[model samples]
Target: MKGLTLDAALARLLIVVLMALTLLPFLSMFSAALAPSGSYPPGLAWPADPQWANFAKAFEVAKMDELLLSSLLIVVGTVPLSVLFATMAGYGLAKFDKGRGRWFYLVFVLGLTLPFEAVITPLYYEIKALGLLNTRFAIILPLIGLYMPFGVYWMRTHFVNTPKELSEAAQIDGASEWKQFWLVHVPLARPAIMSLAILQFLWTWNQFLLPVVLVQDPLQRTMAGALGAFQGQWGTDIPLLCAGALLILAPTIAIFLIFQRQFVAALLQGAVKG
Candidate 1:
């Protein structure tokens, strides 16, 4: 009884500490964003009147609709490419044995550890050389490449979990390789693919440095880039920045919340099977 009581107390204390740490900045930001705009609040007190319209003002000034559309386009293009490439690569790696498999596997795994910063310089030149700079495709193409190794690894793991017998059975039938991949494999991979898509989408949506470095045209840039530009232009207003952040964060947050149950289940299922 004594030990159980102590453990409960510790758990409660840890939770309190964590909640405080997590909520403090947000609470401060909320208060600051609302507290009449001139100075910080007197203490930990929230704003007497939270100016919700600050958000609208931010939207008006920032051309948020355009920013969001740009982000949407990048995400739309990148997600499918990443998934298709990764899935095909992963499936091939898992299913097909060319005997040089170990070398390819090592190289693919090595890609996960390669830092984006290290490749940025070379990537910039490559994009520029291809005459793709200031275009969204420049960012999209690199993202797909960067996503490929991990995507392949993720799908490959899932594919391995799927018994070899499934594919062999399909092959023993008259089904072509493409048909088997599309019909038999793709359906089974829904969970693994969904999990990877959510992860990749969030990463791509929030991507900053790559877009910042590669994109020179403001309208062509993503929401993250636009936010950076927003800061440069109207940073004196904290409320506006917060408001813009809220707008920027809204769609992904809403999507995650809507699919929270599925996301959790998919992650757990993939972990268990893979």
Candidate 2:
């Protein structure tokens, strides 16, 4: 009993330490952002007079309003289409794994092995050829394609673990394939879908490389991608740069905090079932 109690205490301590380690950088950045512009903040030291207005200044300088709109456009273009296709493809693969579906599943599995960096060169050329090199479609289209493998994989995991009896029962009721997917499975797969959407939203929001490579306009790029330009212009102003970075990061943090429960629940379900 004492040994078990000691193990539990140690686990709690470890968790606390990990949390501190994870939070320390953000704390330092937050402190730095509150320091007066152009001054390098001493490591993690609280400023005597915190310049709270730096956030406002950064917002103005970064043109965060436009960036937010552009990011929204890209995310809106990418997430729904990707999720829909992935869910349908996943359902097909999971339901009909006996034949050519296995081949298609293998293709998507192969896609999972591909790294984003490896395809960037070819992708850039392909986008250029399509005359989408400097457009939002450059990011959106590529992201949809890139996300397919993992998205399909994630949805497939959920579909595969679902009771076949539910599908069979729906079939017995004279439901078409479309109705079976829409009415029967989709409603039950809400948690997985929501979790996938959240993950994709975060990924899309933070996308830097594709936006930077494909789009020249800072306003057209994602907030995180445009940080390159923001940093280049404000490199000498440490506090302002940190402030801008924090602003760029704020939405992602806010979203995760709000939907963390759903995310955790989906993850726990996957862990238990998979």
Candidate 3:
């Protein structure tokens, strides 16, 4: 009992230290945002009079309304389609013939190893050739393809771990493969799907490189991607820059907080299976 108590105390202490380390930068940014615009605030120093107008200024100056709308459009375009196709591919790979499925699954796993930097140059030329440059499709199409490897792998894990008896029972009842997938497997995959959607939403929303590279228009790029231009234009306005940064981060933080339980649960489920 004493040993267990001591170990628990140590674990909590470690967690507190880690949390502080993680939150330090955010705290500093928030402090900086509250400082007067055009003033360079020192690190972690709280302003005597918080400049609440800085957020408003950042929003207006950065054209956050447009950025948010563009981000929403991209997320809507990418997440559902990516999730649908990944779910189908994952289901097929999990339940289909062993030999062929294994090979196909290997191809997706190979995709996981291919980094963005490696493919960005070739991807640029291809998108240009297709006349997608500077268009939303430029960002949307590439994101869908980029997300597939992990999306398929994630959903496949869920399907593989699920009991085959459910699928078998549905088939015995005269359900077609499509019906069995939609009715039986999909409902069972609610947690995994929810988690996948959240991950993809965050990824799509926070996506910077692809949007910056593929889409030439700042108005068409994701909020994070547009930040590069925002910084260049208002780089010297420290408080306003910090405010914009916080705005970009707000949605992702809110999403994680809201769905953190499902996210953690899916992670544990996958970890246990592995």
Candidate 4:
């Protein structure tokens, strides 16, 4: 009991330290964002007069309305389709015969090793050939393909670990393969799917490299992707830059907060099973 008590106390202390470490930068950024537009606030020092207008200024200067809409469109286009394809592919890989599925699974696993930087040059040429450069499709199509390996891998792990008995029972009840997948497997895979959606949403929203390279218009790029131009224009304006940075980060933070329970549950579910 004494040892456990000591361990608990140590853990609590470590948590507090970690929390402070994590929050310190955000506190500093918030302070910087509130400082006078031209002035640099040192460390976490609070500005005498908080420049709340900086956020509005940042929004206007960065053209956040356009950026936000573009980001939303890209995410809507990319995440759902990626999830649907990944789920189907994962299920196929998990349930199908080892003879054919293993080779296909290995192909996707190979995809996991192919980093964006490795094929980005050819990808640019390919998009140019398709006349997709400078359009939303350029970013959307590449992202869906880029995200496939991990998405399929994540869903496969969940489906593979799910008990075969459930499928057998469903089959005995006269459920077709399609019915079994949609009715029995999908419901059980909800947590995993939700977690995968969250991750893909974040990745699609924050995607910078592909958007920057593929799309010419800043308005068509992801919010974070547009930040490069925003930064280039307002780089010297520390407060506005900080505000823009915060705005770029806000959606992802909100998403994680809203779905934190589902996310944590999915991750823990996998960990526990493993």
Candidate 5:
């Protein structure tokens, strides 16, 4: 009992330490952002007179309003279609993992091995050929395609592990395959689907390379992608740059904090089931 108690206490201490390490950088950045514009901060100390207006100034100068709109549009275009297709594909693969279906699943699994950098050049050319370069579709389409492998894998794991009796019972009740998928499995897979949506949203929001390479106009690119331009123009202003960075990061952080419970629950559910 004493040994187990000691181990638990040690684990708690480690977790607290890790959490502090993770948050330290954010704390430092926040402190730096509150310092006067164009002034170099001294280490991680908070300013005597915090320049809270720096955030507002950064937002306006960065044209974050437009960037926010562009990001929302891309996310809207990307996440839903990606989730739907991945869910359907995953269900199909789970339901019919034989012969050609096995090959199809293998193809998707192979896609998982492909790194974004490896295919990005070819992807750029393809987008250009299709006249999608520098357009929202350029980022949106590629993101959906890129997200497919993992999204499908996540959903397939959920569907495969589901009790066969559920599908069988649905079939016995005169439910069509489509009905079974829509009415039965999808409802049960809500947590997995929600988790996948949250992940895809985060990825789509933070995507830098694709937006940078495929889209030329900074205004057309994601907020993070446009950060390159913002940094280049304001590289000398440390506090302002930090403020801009914090602004760019704020939305994702807000989203994660709000949905953290669902994210954690989904993960825990997967863990228990798996």
Candidate 6:
């Protein structure tokens, strides 16, 4: 590792800087969240005195519990609905190559290209027509739809890579097509599924724009929405606001810790697997 040429050493230095660039914000936020009360943090130089109570105070001050519950419900509800259909659609597209021109399927894939803003206007009217505005379902349902293209594409890619022999062998036995997918195909899909779950969970959890438009009712406001409001209400309450920011950051950090293996394996999987 130490035998690098000058150019290689410079490249390593650059890479380390870039890595620190990404990590600095999170590190600073964490330090601020734990900094001692009634004083300015040492501006991320290092923690002066760690105050664990900020987390509790943040929850109380921001009324983050309701917002947390709202955000959680959106993620929990949407991930499953979108993943289920996306799995079905992707699997179907991969295996059933007959019935329709692939152009139609490509349209499903192409949807990933369209910017969400281009579609939001139409979506607004559509939500109003359904009388779903100002509701959590309104926010969550649109998010599920918006995220579908990527999920389906990911699962489809995974299914396409799977050897057809597995399905063929399953069909040779008394196993039905559904059974083959569940017992055989799904097992192999773990990495792809995990990746999708991670991306979708984070995306949905931090989602702000859709919720802002579709859900004007504060009672239904999500964590992101509440965070926005909290920013307005307590702009100078650094400790309190940082506390809320950490509140938003906690679940994602926990999730990543829990699934770090999946993330690392997925990285290695991409490097090795097709």
Task: Give per-model TM-scores.
Answer: 0.89, 0.97, 0.97, 0.94, 0.95, 0.86
The TM-score of predicted model 2 comes to 0.97
| Model 5 agreement with the true structure over 105-154: per-residue lDDT tens digits | 88998999999999999999999999988999999999999999988888
Q: Scored by CA lDDT, what does every candidate get?
A: 0.83, 0.93, 0.92, 0.91, 0.93, 0.81
Clash number for each model: 0, 0, 0, 0, 0, 0
lDDT order of candidates, top first: 2, 5, 3, 4, 1, 6
Cα deviation at 227, candidate 3, in Å, is 0.5
Stretches off by above 4 angstroms in model 5 are: 1-4, 269-274
Residue pairs of candidate 3 with colliding backbone atoms: none
- Per-residue lDDT for 1-274 in model 3, tens only? 3556887989988999999999999999999999988999999988999998999999998999999999999999999999999999999999973998999999999999999899999999999999989999999999899999999999998899889899889989999999999999999898889888988999899999998888878989999999999999989999999999999999889988998898788678768865
lDDT of 3: 0.92
Q: What is the lDDT of residue 58 in candidate 6?
A: 79
lDDT winner, 1 or 2: 2
Worst 10-residue lDDT window, candidate 5: 265-274
Worst 10 residues of 1 by lDDT: 35-44
Error of 2 at 178 (Å): 1.0
User: Which stretches of model 4 miss by more than 4 angstroms?
Assistant: 1-4
Residue-wise C-alpha lDDT for candidate 2, range 48-159, written one tens digit per residue: 9999999999999999999999999999999999999999999999998878988889899899999999999999999999999889999999999999999888898899
lDDT of 1 by residue, 30-106 (tens): 66666565454554577778887877787888888888889899999899989988898888888764678757977
Estimate the TM-score for candidate 3.
0.97
Cα error, residue 144 of model 5, in Å, equals 0.5
